[model samples]
Target: MSNLVEFNETSAPGFVLLGFTERAELRLLCFFVFFTIYAVTLAGNLGVVVLIRLDLGLHTPMYFFLSHLSLLDICYSSTIIPQALWSLVVAKPGISFPGCVTQLFSFATCATTECYILAAMAYDRFVAICNPLLYSVLMSQRLCVGLVAGAYLAGVISSTIHTVAIFHLPFCRSKKIDHFFCDGPPLLALSCSDTHLSELVVSALVGFNVLSTTAFIVTSYSRVLAAVFRMRSPPASRKTFSTCASHLVSITLYYGSSLFMYLRPSSRHSLEDDKVVSMLYSVAIPMLNPLIYSLRNADMKRAMRKARGRVLSLATRGSQAPERRGGPLHG
Candidate 1:
């Protein structure tokens, strides 16, 4: 294995990221589409983070996780979208070995981090709903920081392992990756070496991540629902349902698509289908996260309105101040 690594590393193979080459006419269309999605994703996620920070009303554990989730969305899109848009326009779109490794590491890190973060959020929600009284003490600032730190550490560990595993393998002749980005599926497909071990390792790692987080989410939500059902107040029931609904939708979209894409054999993955799914999870989901949270939740809408009003008020005052200074003071 050591000798083989030397040979593969010495060759310094590159990869070509062929992004959505179905129709030449549609390249421009796809470019614009991806551009629009990336733009919206940036605006929405950043807006969420900014709103959470500026608004004291949202200084709870839930909003802390949400702000981090938005930050993760921003990182997620940045990893894949720009290069994808570039691929559409460039004549021979290829990334060097180092560049591909960097891309893989960043993508994996963000994804793995998000998985744990979501789970942490589920636990937060659980405590909030199931044990409203102890929620404050249970989800203290110290514990929140620890959970977030643990998520990041998990991401780093996962990314480091996968990146080393994939790159260590011997990539002989084939350098052209069928889909966009240096995803595990496509990268493994390109490897000339036996990927059985890599696949098993990845499966175990990703499966553990997916299963553990999912199990926690399921357990937490189950308890939450049970607690909500026993509640006598109608408004309380409605509030609890709304809070969980957004998370359920988010988890479903991300986990469902990702499980389908990654938890399968590389041979079973069709290039076209893989590309579409990748775009759906990596590109579309980020743009949707903010909308899912803001549109579904009343508090978010209120914050947005308040934020907008503040901006408008500032603009109004600025305009009046300029007028007053120019008209009376200068004269």
Candidate 2:
């Protein structure tokens, strides 16, 4: 038993993230680009939240889920963009063990939440389109609240399991993580311990989350298509399809990139290539979410205009109040 130890215990305590490796001159360029994305992500998502709150017309189940999606985008971008921007600007892009784990946990949580939220949105569309008469009854305020709560709970549980499985692995060799963020695949590659359990768990979660949600979405859309087709009137069918097109596009882009990254076997792990793919879902998707929703959604555009006007009016009133108070010719 005493002679069973195979390797020494000393190991690197942290990791150096290689980030983007195209060119050194691209560092500033990348930083500015990502900074713009982060700003837009925050403003767009927060704008949606504010619009949903201020506009009575948007106080429905659809907008409620939209608001939560916006919030998830904000949280998701916040988890990765800041650190990524810092890594690009700073000389070193190092992360401690605990920091890496925390980042991984938050990222996984937001991502899982987005998956479930998309499914909920799909279901909402089903009810709204397939059974308009009972839409409100099926998707009451209580039900909406329950669905949002369930999404968050599912996210937390999935993240907890993944993070725990990851941290339990022993790290005894190279600690360099070759990605902009702490993702499951990259972290798994760095583990010296036998990662069969972790790999299996990650694969199972990915399969269950993506495949299950995809099935639900497909079923909902199938029923939706059938309903629209049976209407027989071209205009009505077109309108129904238009209503779901934006959501379908979003779902395709999101799950497409995510599935490409996670669902593949571990033998296909290429840190350099995987990093590029991860950016699509992590950075690009968040930036595109608001554009997709706002451009396609008339209610959101109107609400945004009203909210902007309100802000401008308040600013003008604030400026005039100071001037009126300071006037000296009052009798």
Candidate 3:
């Protein structure tokens, strides 16, 4: 196989990412669509983070985890969308070997980190619902911080292994990637070397990461469900159901798309199909997470109202201040 030809050039090769569409008009349309999505993603995720920080009511472990998830969504979306938008406009959208490595590493890190954070959030809900008396004590500030730190560390480790493993392979074939972003399966397909080992490694890592966290979330929610069922108070049951619903939707969207994209063998991958699925998790979900939480959770909605009121009040005061300054000199 030509892929067996090791990349021995002192200088690294550059790669062109073939974005979603090839036709000139379609590219234009895609550019506008994705740009809007990216803009909304940034505004929404940042708003969530800021809302959590400024609102004292949102200082709980649940909000803390939510804030971090928003940050991660911002991060990974930023890594891919700008480059993808660029690819859509330019004649040849090329990324150097180093740039590709960086993109992959950053994306993988954010994605892996998000999985564990979601799991942590599930545990938080578990404690809140099942062991209400110990909720505060169990999900202490120390434990919350520790969980977040661990998630980040796990991301770094997982990303490092995958990045190093894939990039080390020889790329004697075409440098044009079929998808908009530098994903693993597509990259492996371009490799001149035998990708069995890399595929196994990637699949194993993804399976472990996805399944383990998913199992944890499932178990946590199972207990939560039992507890919810046992509640005799109708209002309390309704409130708890509403709280869990948002998270369940988020988990389904992210994990389902991710599992489909990564779990398959490389040879069976349809690059065209993969691109659409990638958009679901990497682009759409980030933009939707803020909406999911804010629209569903009463606390978040209340905080948003307060924040909006504050903004309006500040704007009104600012508008009046200029008029007063113009009308008369202050003593």
Model 3, 200-264: lDDT tens per residue? 89888889999999999999999999999999999999999999999999999999999999998
TM-score of 2: 0.89
Better structure of 1 and 2 per lDDT: 1
Q: Any runs in candidate 3 off by more than 4 Å, and if so which?
A: 1-12, 321-331
TM per model? 0.93, 0.89, 0.93
lDDT of each candidate versus the true structure = 0.88, 0.86, 0.92
Candidate 1's C-alpha lDDT?
0.88
Per-residue lDDT tens digits of candidate 2, residues 48-122? 888898899999898999999999999899999998987776554677778898999999999998999999999
Error of 3 at 82 (Å): 0.7
| lDDT of predicted model 2 | 0.86
RMSD of 3: 4.9
Q: Is candidate 1 or 3 superior in lDDT? A: 3
**Candidate 3 weakest ten by summed lDDT:** 1-10
Candidate order by decreasing TM-score: 3, 1, 2
